[model samples]
Target: MIEILNPAKLAQARVTGALVADILQALKSRATVGTNLLDIDRWTQTMIADAGAESCYVDYAPSFGSGPFGHYVCTAVNDAVLHGLPYDYALADGDLLTLDLAVSQGGVAADSAISFVVGESPAPESLALIDATQRALRAGIAAAGPGARTGDLSYAIGSVLSEAGYPINTEFGGHGIGSTMHQDPHISNTGRPGRGYKLRPGLLLALEPWVMEDTDELVTDADGWTLRSATGCRTAHSEHTIAITEDGAEILTLPTQDR
Candidate 1:
């Protein structure tokens, strides 16, 4: 369902978005060589509970997944991209890690993701992949505003990934997010401009641009939730929850900073 949040709801969204951002950043800082994936999940759980927020993931059973996710965060590493379920695995130096999170505060939900290298000696390719996804995410956000088409955002995102020589997989992409985690008007990583749903003020969209190094194909892990590149090539994903406004897009998921 497509829900346009009212000002009060939007206010709640901003709070939730900031919480998501803060949690992701904290997880990244704690992610180091030898850190267990389960540790990350636990950290997420603590933060969400402490903030008096609800997790959008745990107990989430979707058709594509095996069953209820039973986790608080998505910890994708190296070849893994989307829906990387936390497992009994330890991180390694130079491993490319992606953390995706969504939470609800005051009944409003916001989502965001980040890709970064864990530990020192990050491979050059890994660094490049992370950079590309970050740039694509910015481009997508820049293209969003009142009256803008969803296609415009997708096109802007795809332009960056394509130029970076990475292939985008459209099986899963961004979507509308509000009281619920995933909502209507799917936003692909690539598309034609001036097409698809028109943006409206107070609309919240999670625009994520993810790319695999070599191919656009992906395969599900035995966990039934983690999606990995078909070629086992490194991957990266970047995302942000944005609000369409009269002035432009406001990145609600940006971590709060002291002035």
Candidate 2:
């Protein structure tokens, strides 16, 4: 469903969004070479509890996923990209890591993701992939605002990634996010401009643009939720929850200092 948050709810949404952003920033800072994915998940649990927020993922059961995601955050490394269920794996130098998170506070939900290299052993190709996703995400957000169409955001995002010489994967992309984690108005990475759902004030969208290094294809891991690159090449994903406003689109998921 497409939910339009009232001013009261928007107030709460801003709070929730800040929490989501802060948590992600904290996790990114705490993560490093040799850090266990499970440790990250545990840290997330503590932070969420300390904030009195509820996790949108722990018990989330979507058709695309195998079952209830029994984790507080998604820890994707290297070849793994989306829905990366945290497991017993230690991050290594040069490993590209992606952390996706969503949480609900005061009945409002916000979602976001970030990708970064674990240590100094940064791979040039991995760095490029991460940069592309970040740029694509920025482009998508720039295209979002009142009176804009979902297609515009998609087109803007796709142009950046495609121009970067990376293949676009639409199997999983952005979506409406509000009271619930995922909602209506599916936003693909690439599409015809001037098409799809029209943007309006009070609408919230999680605009994510993810891509694989070598191919657009994806292969599920044995864990049932981690989506990895079909060619086992490194991948990256960037996302943020934004609110459509009368003046323009406001990025709700930016860090408190960034907002």
Candidate 3:
């Protein structure tokens, strides 16, 4: 379903987005060498509870994933990219970690993701992968505004990832997000401009750019949730929940200074 938030709903979305961003940032800070993936999930749960919010993932039963995610956050490491279910493994130095989170507060929801290197001595390739996704995310956000086509954002994002020499997988991409975690108007990572859904004020979209180092193919882990690169190469993902407005797109997931 596609939801166009009213002013009050949009305000609530901003709050939920900030909370999601803060929780992700906190998890990143706590994820170090030897830190267990399950610990990250626990931290996310605590943060969400303390904020009096609900986790969009805990009871999530999307068809592509195993029923009921049963976790508070997605902890993707190394080759893992999307739908990364938290496991018993501990993070090692130089591991690339991606945390994707979504939460609801005051009846509104927001989603965001961030990929970063854990511990010291991050590989140059890992750093490059993260940078490419980040740049692509920025480009996608820049292309979103009133009357803009979803394809415009996709083209802008794809150009950056392609120029960075990374292949994008359209199997999973961005989408409309609001009262629920996911919604309509699927936003692909790459597409032709001036095509697809037209943007309108009050529309919320989660634009994510993710890429594997060498292949666009993905393999599901035995756990049935974690998606990894076919070649076992490193990967990265970046995302933000944006609201299309008269002026432009507002990044609701940006970290607040005080938080």
Candidate 4:
């Protein structure tokens, strides 16, 4: 469903967005070598409960997933990309970690993700992969505004990933988010411009651009949730929840310190 937030709803959305951003940032800071993936999930639950927020992922059972994903956050490391279910594994130095989170606060939901390297090691390829996704996300956001079409955002995002020599995958991408976690107006990572749903004021969209280093194909892990690169190459993902306004697109998931 395509949900247009009223003034009050938009206010609630802003609050939700802030909470999600803060939680992600906190998790990123806590992620280090030897940190267990399950620990990250537990930490997320604590923070969400403390904030009186609800997790969109917990109890979430979709057709593609195994069943009610009993987790608070998605912790994808290295080859893992989307729908990464937290497991019993400790992080290691130079591991590329992607944390995707969504939460509902004040009846509104916000979603966001971040890819970063864990520990002090910095692998050039890993950094480049993360940078590409971030750049694509920014380009997609920049192309969003009132009257803009979803294709415009996709085109902008695809250009960046293609130029960076990464293949595009449309199997899963961004979507409309509001009272619920996922909504209508599917936003693909690559598409033709001037097509698809047109943007309007008060519309909220989660634009995510993710890519695998050498392949666009994905394979589900044995867990039946985590999506990994078909070629086992490193991957990265970046996302943000944005609101279309009269002036332009307002990024609601930006860090509080950045506001």
Candidate 5:
């Protein structure tokens, strides 16, 4: 399903997107070295409720994941990258954590993710991984606009990651998002330019650029939801929901202060 939000829905989407971004930023601040993953999930649930928003993840039952995610947010640590189910483990110093969140407000939805180190002792490798994903995310966003092809965005994103020496994984990437969490026009982290769907006004896309430090392979954790690097290397993911408009792509998921 590829959903294009009308102006009114897009307005509501901005509100939802800001809420998602604020919550993620707050969670990032609260995630200390000893914070437990389950605690993060609980915090996320509370935040979503306080904002009068519906969690796009808690009851989500997608074919790729264990039914009913049962968590408000994804807490990925160290080697874990995608679909990270909140667990009982407490974050350790230097642990790289990724928080992915989505919510709906006023019948509109937005999704975003951020990766950072848990404590003050972040490793150089972890920092590099995080930086690479962030840069690639920016590149992807820069390549989006009305009339631009999805492949152009992918190529821009892939160039950054490839130059940074990280392996790209295509199994899970960005996609169109509005009204629902995930939608069609899958945006791979890497692809050939001038190919794939052409951008149009009103189209919403969640452009995420994620990569593993060493290999492109992934291994699912015992929880059946968390996806980790096959070589157990550190990973990072950065994402934001953008709306294509007459001028260009407007990032809806940036923190309120950032706008």
Candidate 6:
């Protein structure tokens, strides 16, 4: 479903976005060496509850996933990428962790993700991979505007990943989000420009550009939710929920400090 937010609804969406961004930033700060994945999930639950918000993930039962995702947030470490289910694991130094979160506040939902190294150990390759995804996400957001087609955003994102030498996977990409966690107008990471759905004011889209270091293929972990690189290479993912407006695309998921 394609949802267009009215002015009042958009205002509520802004609040939802801000809350999501703040929570993500908080989680990033708290995640460190020895941080347990379950603990991270607990932290997320507490934050959501304290804010009087609802987790989009907790009881989410999408077709691709195993069942109801009984977690508060997605904790993707190293090879794990999308739909990462939190489990019993302690973070180690230099662990490439991706925290993807979505929350509903005031009846609106916003989704975002961030990738970072766990501790003091900085791996050049890991940093580069994460940086590439971030750069691609920026490119995608910049391409989003009134009248811009989904392909334009995809092309911009794909160019960055391709130039950076990372393989793209289209099976799972960004999508429309608002009033619900996922919606129509699928945004692929790679595509031809001037095609697909046309942008319009008040439309919300979650543009995520993710890539695996070596292969375009993915393998589902035994848990049936975590998606990993088929080649076991490191991966990175970046995402943001954006609203198409008259002036341009307003990135709702940017941190409060950045606002």
Clashing pairs in 3: none
Q: In lDDT terms, how accurate is model 3? A: 0.94
Over 91-114, each residue of candidate 5 has an lDDT whose tens digit, in order, gives: 999999999999999998899999
Model 6, span 1-259: residue lDDT tens = 9999999989999999999999999999999899999999999999999999999999999899897999999999999999999999999999999999999999899999999999999799999999999999999999999999999999999999999998899999999988999999999999999999999999999988988888999999999899999888888999999999997899999888999
Q: Which candidate is the best by lDDT?
A: 4
TM-scores for all candidates: the values are 0.98, 0.99, 0.99, 0.99, 0.99, 0.99
lDDT of 3 by residue, 156-257 (tens): 999999999998899999999998989989999999999999999999999999999999999999888999999999999999999999989999998886
lDDT of 2 by residue, 1-259 (tens): 8999999999999999999999999999989889999999999999999999999999998888898999999999999999999999999998899999999999999999999999889989988998999999999999999999999999999999999999988899999999999999999999989999999999999999999988999999887899999999999999999999998889899899897
lDDT of 2: 0.94
The all-Cα superposition gives candidate 1 an RMSD in Å to the true structure of: 0.9
**Which runs in model 4 stand beyond 4 Å of their true positions?**
none
lDDT of 1 at 187: 97
Q: Please list all clashing residue pairs in model 4, or write none if there are none.
A: none
RMSD (Cα, Å) of model 4: 0.6
Number of colliding residue pairs in model 5: 0
RMSD of every candidate to native, in Å, equals: 0.9, 0.7, 0.9, 0.6, 0.7, 0.6
Writing each residue's lDDT as its tens digit, candidate 4 over 17-49 gives 999999999999999999999999999999999
Candidate 1, residues 1-259: lDDT per residue as tens digits? 8999899999888899999999998998899899999999999999999999999999889999997999999999999999999999999899999999999889999999999998888899999999999999999999999889999999999999999998878889999999899998899999999999999999999999999999999999999999999999999999999998888999999988720
Q: Show how many residue pairs clash in every candidate, following the order shown.
A: 0, 0, 0, 0, 0, 0
For each candidate, the alpha-carbon lDDT, in order, equals: 0.94, 0.94, 0.94, 0.95, 0.93, 0.94
For candidate 4, give the lDDT. 0.95
